[model samples]
Target: MNKSLLKLTFTFVALLFGLNTFAQDDFQGKAYYMSKTTMDMDQWGGREMSPDQKKRIEERMKSFLEKEYILTFNKSESIYKEDEKLEAPGSGRGWGGFASSFTGGPKYKNVKDQELLQDQEFFGKQFLIKDALKPLEWKMGTETKQIGQYTCFKATATKVVDEFDWRSMRRRQPPPKKKDSSETGDSAKADSDDPMNEIEVPKTIEVVAWYTPQIPINQGPDDYWGLPGLILEVNADRTTILCTKIVMNPEEKEDIDKPKKGDEVTQAEYNDIVTKKMTEMREMYSGRGRRN
Candidate 1:
């Protein structure tokens, strides 16, 4: 073959190889996910403020999810109600019925959003397949049981801690001024810059996922994708997200949408809110029984 013809042939071969590789690794399936995490606070830590706490927690989770992933069919409704009018044997007005009963259908969060959460300007984007194989070189550990459906593979990731860093891209917080000052003064602001006090990094986060090659879509329940099949489980840091139910091509067809335009906020802002709430929760529990 001539030089130009040989070059063209090689390029075409490479393109075909890339497409086939992607198709082979893709797993397309539906998953019902539930994220269970240890409460940042104790029982009395705002989580026990009647049934209202549940809704608040759900909202917080939703907001956190908004940082990454495009949610689909995300709906919730109260299913349980109490008739407060009924008189109890000992209570005077009787206890009001709790509205805790609730059920919602499957919610789809696209893998693309996961990267966006790490950085906002990266919206409506996709990551290269090779990026998924980056080193830390964490190992893919043993398989464990999940939802009694399939054995899960474990993956670990870690990063060196960076102090004084900010999440301005992940949230919608106001920009920091060159000479910003709060009523508390510089000392308070300085304290927030210390990363050692916040937590350590190279922190090990464990992820468990079940990939079934039967489906050929490159996607998972949450921010997890790139596996050979659908990811049925994913656990990161204090959170454990799992697939409770799986429906392979259900009768209904629907398109999932990403959080866009007005729905999106700056990353810094979201982090500020989360950090403030976390601090409040920590203080409430840590200062219990200690009078001011």
Candidate 2:
């Protein structure tokens, strides 16, 4: 063979082998997430609920207070779903009513397309939430930390959300208390510790996330993303979702397909729907209290 022709042939063979090897090196990923929720029980406490009642409420909701999830992803696509939960049915009581109010369903994100798909259930009806990814501005920090074996960088961003958001069944503001002429002085005024006064609708939330460049993916649990790497820990709105473990290129690559069930709606539209529904329920319960 001619010397130049032989060199070209060898180069072509090496290129083909490199491409094959890259194709076989799976980037399929799996990440485990655990979320903890803490609510301001001030409204339910005070004169409305006694110490015994507060204890009951907390004990009953021990299971719903925390959640676990698993995120399956690749380089450009990902799906986040809840892990197996052992929660029993909630009763028709104080925060317990919130149990049936919000359940974080499967969320699918296509980083390549900048789209989002989330499955939600409210009062037994399914809703498929489809919307564009919320644009985030993360300030990268010079700090680095180790989460497991991966070195992670710090990122922070501000997230503004509806004050009455029930997505997480969080502390939604209720109807303002009416001033009574008979009650005078500071005793009548709402206390500063009252969360209802401090935390109102249209609240600003700060997001702190730690992501690992080793993962090289803009993916995280729930609605969090737009980071330089896969987020291993996220804290926002007093809730935290931390990565318990990660398995890259898992043998069983679970489906990353988008959920195709339920009534379709956008993020804003769904928020409005939940606000209206929660208001109605609140009114119904208040009327019952008045009658009692």
Candidate 3:
């Protein structure tokens, strides 16, 4: 072959080889999640409300409880977020409203590094919570279930959590017990301890998850992860997050960037900061109401 023709042929062959290699190492994938939150609003006046009123409340709550999320992940890292208002079929940015403040935020997890970065917003303040991934002592089970054509295995874990335990926070103040002559030192010491303090401590929450080894990725939505495979369903504290769809290696892979712009704090620190600010706001509004 002539020199010019040989050069052209070599370039074409190289391009084909590059494309073939790209096809082999797929790497990137996206998982769509839909979260369902079942609320028992008894303390919030659910018991007093009529059936019609309850139905109307439930209808209004559909938008808040049923949320769509997308997790774009590779071998070691993944970004999980809520679907934007007008996101295309598979694309979404998970920044949500006030409801999300009490639950979660846009999280980026690197399983290999055991690191997590979350973009959290409370009221109007933005927070970038950087923390180690929450550890779960997952007990893998032998049971199997089908989740969207994928065979998934059951796993259970117990987590110490306080975020969703509203019942403990609402325990009726115990009535004063008459002091007995025999009940002096230890019993008095117990009474001196505040009941609210005990309830405020974190309690153990059971987490049930189903994962599929077919995907060969250690990833899941929110703080639930560290499984042997990709998690398809998670039931935690009366909330369920299910993976509805999965797409691998799209035509154009979008860049997954770490969130940077916000007040940097650990997950616990952020929660404390938010809780303090909210308490202050509530006290301020209550004061205004009294004056009015």
Candidate 4:
């Protein structure tokens, strides 16, 4: 075996031995992550927009694109949530308002139990999404790097994109030109009436993660986990989430509780509910446009 692979193997063995001696109840960690997503302005008609107009749009969507999160974990369970901050008046008004409905609340993951629960508030209604933890068949590599004070190993996986995950969504490319021009005007008018026609989500995305065996806990921000150690960074599609700070066994630790204040539904059912609501919204807007 290569030197890097040998070293990683030895570390894994040591981690396995160490876990048995560790105090699971008293041991806890809090990881602070900064999440940022890149948006392609050109895909969203940026070429025709002036610099000021584009800046305004970006400012309005800033909260949705950039965020901070905290992951609190023990050996088997963890709660990942956004570090909420008060926004200025009129902030997050247009596109941000639309995205907020899909953004979930505190997410609880129990690795030992293979359980996942998330709290979501959609259009003034609460939903608790209950489901099994989505497993990733990660291909581990012998590559090594340093993140903060820990030695990190590289791992990769292909994730099936969730239909409602807006991070992987993009504007659909315009349709090809047709030889028959008779239906052109009607097609354009119909497409303009429904906003959902412009959006598209990819089927899959490549996920790259860096994990440190030093922590020896299978926990990560958002929906990522199952590594041999704590995942310190995740680069998936247009979004990147990196660990900025880690607090191990702080004096005051928050309880890792599963949210129970919403209508219980599975992930698939929640997606269907959102899809139906969005379709209804599209029809309402289309009817209003016709009347005008």
Candidate 5:
């Protein structure tokens, strides 16, 4: 072959080999992330619950959350999927009392936690930002860590609220109820009560995510993503999901396919469910407290 032809032939061979290597590389395409969580009862406002109660609550929470997630990425597309399951608010005396009052005055009593658990189901979805691949401002952080043999980087995010998130809601600020003249003295004392003022100061939450570049897959336990590597530690909302095991590029290449067309709920909708339930719960507790 002539010099130029030989050069072209060499280049073509190199390209073919590079493409083959890329296709077979364990860390190149898609990955799966899973974790087991042991949320602290006190951390989640279940401080009043006994250890056994907390254990039951945790089991229910974990079972509801137990899911398989798939992440897919290539030069052209990216996608995600959560194995679907039915979920409902877990039940206990506290949750039951709250639900009973809010749904109307005691249509039910001593409801089994299992029966209550069937009322709802919530999960995350595939997020397709127009340019999800073109990197944005995200740092896996400076903290060095190891999840299994893979060394990881840390990342953090923060949120702050000066007032209750629902303070601006019209329904939240109800017109003062008219007090009967016969109960004026007691009503006057009740009117002076302020429950909002009793809330403990919101504590600052810092999340430290451990990502391993070895994995080369930007994925995490939930909606968290866009890190330089697979996230091994996820701390948010006072709850943490740590990766106890991470196996990269196993002998058998597992296919990770993204959910197609209508498999999961939007993040906004999920937020609404949680907000509504929490509001209902608060209202239930509020009505049970005797006016001072």
Candidate 6:
């Protein structure tokens, strides 16, 4: 090659590298998401309740069912958290307390490093769940839709539901009636009295996600990620998380750092811990009921 041509090629490559670095350093975005989950009232004994009772139950559950979250992202890192707001008086009673105990706090993801760090406060104990990012095998489709000013493409995946994920939990169906008396032993009666035996979670759930190439960041709310673009909407089983607003390169940027203030544990280990604690509570409640 001629000397001039070689020099020009080198210059072009250097310019490209510099521009990529600059873009990574200066690019930041904040995505606001509104999440809502629908529950089958009949499955939760709502059918037995009066109309007024059902309405009150729904009102209390609204705090958990409908929520807003913020996802702040830069090139390879992102932090997702619920948007904090004051609860109405008496909204945090009964089931709210149980839900809050199992709910996780801010979650931080490092896409480049393939790391996930989440803060979870189960009951009164705090745990830092440090684990590899769970990759979803997404089947991308040619379908397209417009979300605000951005065009989004469709993708779907089947996710194995976590054992302790309450979002997929449902009341266990009763066993079929047995004509013989042998099936209704004392052991079976004891099991029926334990409330914990009534709850069950699905093994897997189908997730449909909508991602936009305009953002060009592989990030999403909750545990959803690994797309070619930023995910704008997610339909996972009973829950829907939709992006409501986007702020690009905002002047005030929040730090995307891993949570450090908790006993470190892997995702599986944390699940086990929660499971053990729940079992203990269940046993205690059963003992008290037997005593009465």
**What total of clashing residue pairs does each candidate reach?**
12, 2, 1, 0, 3, 0
Q: Pairing residues by index, what is the TM-score of model 6? A: 0.90
Per-residue alpha-carbon lDDT of candidate 2 for residues 1-292, written as tens digits (9 for 90 to 100):
9865664454456445534433543568899988887766774453588889887777766566677889999878899987865445563244544654565478899998999998878787889989999877999775777888876778899888654554333434555766755655443332332333434444577889998766667888888898757899998876888999988677777778988999999978988998798667656655555456
Tens-digit per-residue lDDT, 208-292, candidate 4: 9999888888889999999989999999999999999999888998888888999999999999999899888988888787778
Candidate 3, which segments miss by more than 4 Å at Cα?
A: 1-26, 86-96, 162-202, 285-292
> Candidate 5 on 1-292: residue-level lDDT in tens?
7865664454456445535544643443444545333434574457788889877877655543334444443322234444344456553344433332222110101111111000123223222111112222454345565566656666676534223222111112334676655556545444434344234434333456766655544445444556655666676554456665443345565453332333234334545556686566555555565532
lDDT of 6 by residue, 50-112 (tens): 999999889888888888999999889999999978887888466656776666899999999
Question: TM-score for all predictions?
Answer: 0.40, 0.74, 0.74, 0.93, 0.44, 0.90
Which candidate gets the maximum lDDT versus the true structure? 4
Residue pairs clashing in model 6 are none
Top model number, TM-score:
4
TM-score of 5: 0.44
Report, for every candidate in turn, its global Cα lDDT versus the true structure. 0.38, 0.73, 0.73, 0.90, 0.44, 0.86
RMSD of each: 15.0, 9.7, 12.2, 2.1, 14.0, 7.1
Cα lDDT for residue 114, candidate 6: 99
Ranking according to TM-score, highest score first: 4, 6, 3, 2, 5, 1
Model 2: runs farther than 4 Å from truth?
Answer: 1-26, 40-43, 46-56, 87-97, 164-202, 282-292
Clashing residue pairs in candidate 3 are 82-94
**Looking at model 1, how many pairs of residues clash?**
12
Off by over 4 Å in 1: 1-28, 40-138, 142-146, 159-206, 263-292
